[model samples]
Target: MRVGVDIEDGGLARITLRRADAGNAIDLAMARGLLDAARACAHGSVRAVLLTGEGRSFCVGGDLREFGALSGAALERHLMAVTDALHDALRTFAGIDAPLVAAVQGAVAGAGIGLAAAADVTLAADDASFTAAYTGVGYSPDAGVSWSLPRLIGPKRALDLLLTNRRVPAGEAAAIGLVTRVTSPDRLAAEARRTAESLRRGPTAAFGATRRLVAAGLSADLGPHLDSEARALAGLAVSDVGREGVAAFLGKRDPDFTGGAHRL
Candidate 1:
């Protein structure tokens, strides 16, 4: 399998890119594998997901070699198929209630940047670097990179990266809002796992609501957004997880969100 998926007992799903030899580049098979993995997480009892790459680079981008093998309409069709699966995977991950965490290292470019930015929490190794390599290869963005980049780093910065394909080091990437934080390379895996585990123990339904709220707030007017928030909070307040959370808070103890009847 080009993608390795493991769901732990506490509902933490770990998705690893297994093509270490190719810098985890997204070939057609890997793209399909990713979609399968994302669907598994979405359909299972997963409460959180951690995405990581197995080797020196998180991902360099798509497999140009594979693309280079084709031409004319064949290339177009092949790329469409690859992006279709990859985009579906991204959508599936976003639609899931489970929060997604990504730990990126080494080179991150093109679709790799898209995958990292799509995560709710992106942790980058200090040595990691990011670049928008699409233009360099005479290709446009895919895997939602164009949409995510502007939202993440603003229009000017996003355009600059996309047009120039200049490399942004980890520190600069973090400062520019490309990643949530930066950690030492050695600590990337541990920190990502710890973060995912922490999220796994929280109220997943509330997390999902909050995620949707934030996404909606990006385009929603204040009055309607407030109404949405009110409705969401009111509904969650009566839920089993919410009740447990309140009771635990009043009792001065940690809440066991996983033990709730809803288990959401």
Candidate 2:
């Protein structure tokens, strides 16, 4: 399988891209594997998810070499199949309750950029670099790049990267809000694990609500957004998890939200 999934104790799920030989390139099989992994995470009781690559580079994008062999109708069919699977995976990852943390290293290009951008929190290794390779390859954006990029770094900056296809280094990427944190290469794995662990012990449903609210805010008008926020807040306030959190706050204790304890 081109994707590996490991669900650890305490509801932390780790998903790794496993095509190290090709910089974890997304082939049809990889896309299918990704979709399966994503579906597993969403369907399970995972509290947090960690996404990373298994080799030197995070992901170099699609398997263009595979594409190079096809032409005309064959190429069209192959492309559609790959995108169908990839889009399903992306959609599942974005809609799930578990917060996503991506630990990226080496090169992140094309669809890889979209994957990183979709993360709730992205951490980059010191040596990490990002590029938008679509235009250079005589293609347009896919893998949710067009939808996530502009929301991430603003439309103008997103356009500049898309049009120029320039490489953005780790530090610059963090400064531009492309990544949440940048750590030394030696410490990247440990830091990412620690971050996911911390989130695993948090209120999973609350984390999901915050993420969804932010997504909703992008397209919602002020009045409607306020109404939506009010409704969400009210819903959470009465939830079992919310009551436990309130009690914990009053008693100066840690809140526990495990095993559907948060439901009522």
For candidate 2, lDDT tens digit of each residue in 66-179? Answer: 999999999999999999999999999888878999999999999899889989999999999999999998989999999988988999999999999999999999999999
Candidates' lDDT values, in order? 0.93, 0.91
TM-score of each: 0.97, 0.97
lDDT of 1 at 59: 93
Over the stretch 1-264, how does candidate 1's per-residue lDDT look in tens digits? 999999988789999999999999999999999999999998548999999999999999999999999999999999999999999999998888889999999999989999999999999999999999999989999989999999999999999999999999999999999999999999999999999999999899888888889888988999999999999998889998789999999999999989743423
Model 2 residue runs over 4 Å out of place are: 259-264
Against the true structure, candidate 1 has what lDDT?
0.93
